[model samples]
Target: MRMNAKDEAEMEYFGSTIRLQNENVTLRDTVQALNAALSARDDELANIEDELSDRENEVTRCERALELRVAQFNQEAEELVQQKEDHRRLKLECKKLQNQNKIE
Candidate 1:
């Protein structure tokens, strides 16, 4: 089958057009896939940020609780020290009275 020059030119042009269309379709699909991947990554980043914020809040709450506990412990320690001093004073007074009676 011999193709005339005009027919040959037309066939070449048709083949070139088909190749260009295929390339365009491939490029479109690639761009769509990349966009989808980028969107998923952005969502993941947002979720991580939310989780980080929550954890930071929890840490702050724990620090406040610990501070309260420390304050309570200090107050209780001060009370115990005052009680011990009172006990010591009473014991000394009782001994002094007993010695005075013996001297009389």
Candidate 2:
């Protein structure tokens, strides 16, 4: 048996309503997934920032140690130069005394 125009119209309306409800559910699920992804990314960013800070602190420590080593080397170099000068003066004095003794 063929349906009347009224029954056909009601059936079309019901089908359209079901489609709209399905589309609404799909949109809600998509929004929830995007939010979760964004939260995870934010957590990763925070961890990276912490690592960067730690590296910066390590670099500062290394720089200070290098400066201290440089200072120590400079002091050692100065002492060596002074010792050489003293040795040369002593040798010259010994040579003068030997020459005088030989003339006498």
Clashes of each: 0, 0
What's the CA error at residue 60 for candidate 2, in Å? 1.8
Give me the overall lDDT of model 1.
0.97
Model 2: how far residue 19 lies from native, Å: 2.0
lDDT by residue for model 1 over 1-104, one digit each (tens)? 99999999999999999999999999999999999999999999999999999999999999999999999999999999999999998899888999999999
Error of 2 at 98 (Å): 4.2
Quote each prediction's TM-score.
0.78, 0.74
Best prediction by lDDT: 1
Alpha-carbon RMSD to native, per candidate: 2.2, 2.5
Per-residue alpha-carbon lDDT of model 2 for 1-104, expressed as tens digits? 99999999999999999999999999999999999999999999999999999999999999999999999999999999999999999899999999999999
